[model samples]
Target: MRIYKVGGAVRDRLLGIPVTDIDWVVVGATTEEMLAKGFRPVGADFPVFLHPKSGEEYALARTERKSGRGYGGFTFHASPEVTLEEDLIRRDLTINAMAEDDQQNLIDPYHGQRDLEARLLRHVSPAFAEDPLRVLRVARFAARYAALGFTVAPETLELMRQLSESGELEALTPERSWKEISRALMEDQPQVFIEVLRACGALKVLMPEVDALFGVPQPPAHHPEIDTGAHTLSVLEQAALHKQPLTVRWACLLHDLGKGLTPEEEWPRHIAHEFKGLKLIKAVNERFKAPRDCQELAMLVGEYHTHGHRALELKPSTLLELLQSFDVYRRPQRFEEFIAACEMDARGREGLEERSYPQADYLRGASTAARTVAVQPLLEKGFKGPELGEAIKRERLKALKAYKEQV
Candidate 1:
């Protein structure tokens, strides 16, 4: 059997990127033969094994047939007769379809190298439309290579649009959808992911809450971009620029959903959009089965991001209440993440990206000062039960009042 290094490792190597993992495709190999050679079976859907020494994944060269609808409705055929070319043609993107032999000979039956040089993300074949997941995958690749000047081929984008309109995207499981989305959010240009999805209409299907924001108007004075959707994308871009974590990035993306739900008469104003956005954020979190930390942070940001923007204007009691709401003393990291998300929101407006966000430092300092209020001191004064809680609140408020005065 001849083994060829395939997929991302080969693609990234051609792009002069540091390859993180290597996947191999074995031509002219049977499952029995792979097992006899000491490879451990690990694939759940098809014939895949792990090298006994390196533990890298080795999948048999295979061809797939679309048996029905959605991504899972496929039958894979793997045998000694399956050619390397046949396996390569089944990949989603041409750049990912190339392979390399042990002698380092490049195999480009699909001209993946040519597409790579052109900085284009093109489909391997017309068969690309058979899997709905490819739409998300292509968008993710767009996000990854956006810095490298890559653009999705027009034909491939048309195919993606067709797939989006085919009702197939609705068939994707929450786990699978989130897998692609979470990965895209970590990419360097995650805003492009949303743009691509919106272009293909998948955002309307998978995340209508976000889709609804596109045409929604906002006060031009606060948001020079004017379009709420444009503002959201700007926020995501800011989060990326700041190198914020996934939780913060996600919060920035969904922070303005309530703007879309405002009455037309409200026009440029969304007075209580923060309160209105909580349900939409929760729905998105539940639909994606997002991690608890991500969901929790998103919810907090949705409900109180305005409070963060107005940190200096809030009364000392209100500031203390906001700190207590976030449980800043016990969960300081999450509080930090919330501040980062709020900073992204404040900076997302057109022409405001480089503007200072003193609210973040102010709130952080407030949390720190409030956290220093000693419960032991209050208890030593013979405060007990309800009295102890009241005394601690009084001291924390007093400290915040003094802190506010200093600011």
Candidate 2:
């Protein structure tokens, strides 16, 4: 019996990219042999198993049936009728279809190596249109590998477009859609995926609110070309260029979502945008079933985007009081999130960029900088704790006063 390494783990290794996971294929081992070897029977419905000693997964090569609709519509056949070559035939792309034998022998049954050399993502078979989920998956691969600068094979792209228009993917439950959407959001080049989604027509069905953002207008001074949708994607691109975490990036993607639903008025009449934004935030979070902490961070960002003159006028003590008043510390993770959101809010506008809103100074130097301010010394210096806190309060007043004098 010969076993081999397979899939992205092998492909990534060959390309010298850091592999994120490892997969294996045993060409001749039966499930009973695997079980006899103490592997756990984990694929009662699917033929996958987990080795007791290694914990890595192993699955018998299999083929699929378009038995149902959407993601769940597929049925599998792995017992005898299908071979490893047949299983590989149903895979979405050649780059993902090749396998590696334990002896490091290269398996090129589908010429996947040639496609990899050519930087192409070609479907294994014309059957790509049978599953709607492949549309998003291919788009996601584009995003993930956008840096690699490969192009999707023309036939594969056509298949994606056809499947999307056929509404086959619409049968996917919110959970399944969320799976791809969440991964797409987490990708290093999310905008690439989004643009590809738009190109393929999947965006319209997957997220109309976002799809509607295309060509939506923004203030002329801030954004010279395109509308609010373009601005949001730009912000998302900026977030991607940094090390900001997933939830923060998600906020950046959705921060200006309200603009799509808001009617036109004067410059920045989108004053009520934050309130409307809060409601929309809930819908997005609930629709995607995002985590609880993410929901709070989203709403807080939506609420304070209009932070007003107090932001410019408040004393540091008052600022601390204000921060404490909102119980911001109740969720420290949420506070870190708010800073990221603020970066998005302040950076999301083209007008702000045009004016050179002192990008770094605004987000890092001014808004989110941490101040320790000798707390123990203030308490030790003849003032009671309350008095000391009040003194710290006064210290903020002094700072704000100095700021006003400078201004």
Candidate 3:
């Protein structure tokens, strides 16, 4: 059997990027032969094995045919007869279809290297439309490589449009869709992922809440971007620019969902949009099965981000209530993430990206001041049970008031 390093490991190496994972494709190898050689079988639907020594994945070269619908609706054929070219042809993108042999020979059957140099993400074949997951995969690649000036090829985009209109994207499982969404959000240009999905019409089908924001108007006084959708994407861009974590980025993306729900007559104003957004955030969270931390933070930011923005004007009682809602004393990191999301929102507007967000530091300082009021001191003063709770609340409010006045 001839083993060749393939897929991302080959592509990333060619791009002078640090290759994180390596995959091997074996030509002329059968599953029985792989097992006989002490390789551990791991793939349930195909002939994939872990190396006997390195524990790296090495799958026997296989070809697939579209069987039904969605990503998992494919049947695979793997045997000694399967060619390396056949396996490479089934990849989602041209850049990923290249391979490297043991002798350091580059296999360019589909001109992947040519497309890579052209900074285009071209599909390997028309068969790309057969698997709906490739739509998200291509968008994610666009997000990852956008900083490098890479864009989806026009023809490839048309195919993506076809997939989006085919109603096949609905066949994808929530878990699988979330995997792509979360990874794309963490990429260097997370907003590009959303933009690309929108360009191909997949966003409307997969994330209607987000899609609805595109043409909605916002008050230009606060958001120079004007369009709610543009503002949401800008917030996501700010989150990525600051190298914020996934929870913060996800929160920023959904924080403005309520604005999309605002009535057309309301125009640039979205009264209580934060409250309106909470339900949409909950819907997205439930649909994608987002991580508990991500779901909780998104909900918090959606419901109370306005309170965070109005930190300077809120009464000490209101500040304390906000902190209590966040349970800042117990889950301090979530509070920090909430503040980060709010800051991203504040700075996401056009010509306002570099503007200072004093609200962030103000809220952080408020939390600190409230936290400094020692519960132990009250306990020593004989405050007990509910009385102790009341006394501590009173003390925290007093501290917050003092801190606010000093600022």
Candidate 4:
């Protein structure tokens, strides 16, 4: 049997980037023969083995046939007779289809190296349309390599558009869809992911709430970008630029959903949009089965991002209430993330990308001051039960009032 290193490891290696994962394809190997060696069986549907020493995955060279619908509708055939070229042709992108031998000889039956040099993401074959997941995968690759000036080939994008219109993306489970989306959000250019999805019509199919924002108008004075959709993407861009975590990035993406619901008669004004956006955020969270941290932070950012922007002007009582709403004393990290998302929104407008966001520091300082209020002092005064809780709140508010005065 001959084994060749395949997929992302080979691609990243060619690009002079650090290779984090390594997969193998073994030609002229049978399941019984693999078992006779030290490899351990791991695959549920096909013949895949884990190396006893390195624990890396190794699968027999195989070919696939589309048997049903969605990403999981494939039937596989793996045997000693399957060729490496056959296995390579079935991959989604040409750059990912190349392999390397033990001697470090590059195998490029599908011109993956040529496409890589061209800075293009091209499909390996017309068979690329069989799996709907490739649409997301290609967009994710676009997001990942956009810094390197790589773009999807026009013909490949046409296929993606066709797949989007075929009703196949609807069959994707929320778990699978979210897996791509969350990964894409954490990429260096997260907004490119959204742009690619919108270009291919997948955003309209999977996330109509976000897609509807494209043509929606916003006050040009506050949002020089004018288009609400453009503003949302700008927020995502700022979140990525700051190296924010996934929860913060997710919050940035959903913070302006209510703006899409504004009446055209009202034109650029969207009064009370913060209150109108909470239900939309909850719906998106439930639809994608986002983690509780992501769900809660997104809702908080949606319902009160305006408060964050107005931190300097709010009354001391309102400031204390906002801090209490975020539970700053208990979940300080989440409060910090909320502040970051709000700052991203404030800075996301056109020509405002470099503007200062003093509100973040103000809110953070307020949280620190309130958290420093001693509960032990209340206990010493004989406060207890519900009365103690109320007393502690009063002292925290008093501390915030003093902080407001000094700052």
TM-score of each: 0.98, 0.82, 0.98, 0.98
* Model 4 accuracy (lDDT, Cα): 0.94
lDDT of 2 by residue, 1-407 (tens): 45667888878987789998888766566778778888787755677888798899888777788887787788887664456787778888888888887778788688888888888878888878898888888888888888888778888888888888887876877777778877887888887888888887888877777787786676676455447777777777766766577777777776666766766554333556766676777787887787766566666666664452236655555556545534543444565566665665556555554233333343223223323234577676788858877886565455444544554
Flag regions of model 4 displaced more than 4 Å.
Answer: none
TM-score of 3: 0.98
Report, for every candidate in turn, its global Cα lDDT versus the true structure: 0.94, 0.70, 0.94, 0.94
The deviation in Å at residue 403 for candidate 4 is 0.5
Measured with C-alpha atoms, the lDDT of residue 226 in candidate 1 is 95
Residue 289 local lDDT, model 4 = 95
- The clash count of every prediction, one per candidate, is 0, 4, 0, 0
Q: Which stretches of candidate 2 lie above 4 Å from their native place?
A: 264-271, 306-310, 313-326, 348-407
User: Could you give candidate 3's per-residue lDDT for residues 132-185 as a string of tens digits?
Assistant: 999999999999999899999999999999999999999999999999999999
Q: Tell me which residue pairs clash in candidate 3.
A: none
Model 1 misplaced regions, further than 4 Å: none
**What would the per-residue lDDT of candidate 4 be over residues 280-379, giving only the tens digit for each residue?**
8898999999999999999999999999999999888899899889998899999999999999999999999999999999999999999999999899
lDDT, residue 350, model 1: 93
Q: What C-alpha lDDT, on a 0 to 100 scale, does residue 163 get in candidate 2?
A: 87
Model 2, residue 307: displacement in angstroms? 3.2
lDDT of 1 by residue, 300-384 (tens): 9999999999999999999999999899889999999999999999999899999999998999999999999989877788999
